[model samples]
Target: MWVLVLFDLPTETRKDRQVATRFRKSLLDDGFSMFQFSIYMRFCASRENADVHARRVKKSLPKHGKVCIMQITDKQFGMIELFHGQKEIEPEKPSQQLELF
Candidate 1:
């Protein structure tokens, strides 16, 4: 499973910028990778695990902006296509090594 987090936090003032930076740091501390400036992604072992992370993200949301979360299966995540300009870039692939529970 994958937990995708997308957020847009205000940065109109110094305090707002600080708040946004703190929020981004918190996401990294919680094991999310920066898929984009406001988009973060993390891999979870199962649906329940994804829910746990989603709730964690929910609790960390900022007061003045929007936050969204999505949960996708490995197969669904694999089907995502990325593009830079007019070229279609290769999407991220799942790791091949088996994981021991």
Candidate 2:
């Protein structure tokens, strides 16, 4: 499972910039990695784990911005095609999580 957080926050004023920065920091602190300027993604071992992160993202949303939370299966994510200046690039592979009994 993958939890993708996409947001566009206001950064016109100092306070707005601070709030936006805090939001990004919170996402990083919660284990999400930057996928793009306004996109962050985290891999989870299960749907339940993804839900937890999605809830956390909701809890930290800024008061004056647009935010979206999306969940995709590993297969779906793997099908994504990336490019850099017309050259094809491979999509990122999710890190394997160690499980302990």
Candidate 3:
């Protein structure tokens, strides 16, 4: 399974920018990879693990902006199509198989 987080936080004030930057750092520290600006994804071993990460994301969400957490199976995540500008780009591969839990 995969845990995907999408967020948009106000960055007008210095404090707001600091908060936003801290939130992004938290995601990386929690093992999420940046999928795009304000978007992050992490692979989990199971739905339970994904839920744990989803709740973590919820807890770190900024008070000023909207945040969304979604869970998808490995197959569904793998099915994603990708493109960069006018050229196609390879989508992210799922986590290595049979990783020691």
Candidate 4:
């Protein structure tokens, strides 16, 4: 599964910028990688793990902004088509994770 965090936070004031920066930093600290300017994604081994991260994202959300969290199966994510200009590019493949009990 993949957890995608998309947000549009205000940055007009210094405090607003600080809050936006902190939110982005928190996402990175929580293992999400930048997919686009406003999109971050993290790969999870299960739905439960994804939910955990989603909750964390919610907890760190800015007071004034729009944020969206989405979960998609590996198959669905793999079907995404990317492009640079008019040239097509392959989407990144998810790394295999090893879990130990």
- lDDT: which is higher, 1 or 4? 4
Clashes of each: 0, 0, 0, 0
Model 2 lDDT per residue over 54-99, tens place: 9999999999999999999988998898999899998877787886
Clashing pairs in 4: none
Best by lDDT: 4
The reply for model 3, stretches above 4 Å from the true place, is 95-101
- Looking at candidate 1, what is the lDDT of residue 12? 94
Tell me the lDDT of candidate 2: 0.94
How would you encode candidate 1's per-residue C-alpha lDDT over 2-87 as one tens digit per residue? 89998888999999999999889988999888889999998888899889889988888888998889898989988888999989
lDDT of 4 by residue, 73-93 (tens): 989998898999999998887
Tell me the TM-score of each prediction against the true structure. Answer: 0.88, 0.95, 0.90, 0.95
lDDT values, one for every candidate: 0.87, 0.94, 0.89, 0.95
Report lDDT (Cα) of residue 77, candidate 1.
Answer: 86
lDDT of 3 by residue, 18-92 (tens): 999999999999989999998899999989888888888888888898888889998988788888888888886
Candidate with better lDDT, 1 vs 3: 3
* Whole-structure CA lDDT of model 4: 0.95
Q: Of the pair 1 and 3, which is ahead by TM-score?
A: 3
lDDT: worst 10-residue window of model 3: 92-101
Candidate 2, residue 87: the lDDT equals 100
Lowest lDDT block of 10, candidate 2: 92-101
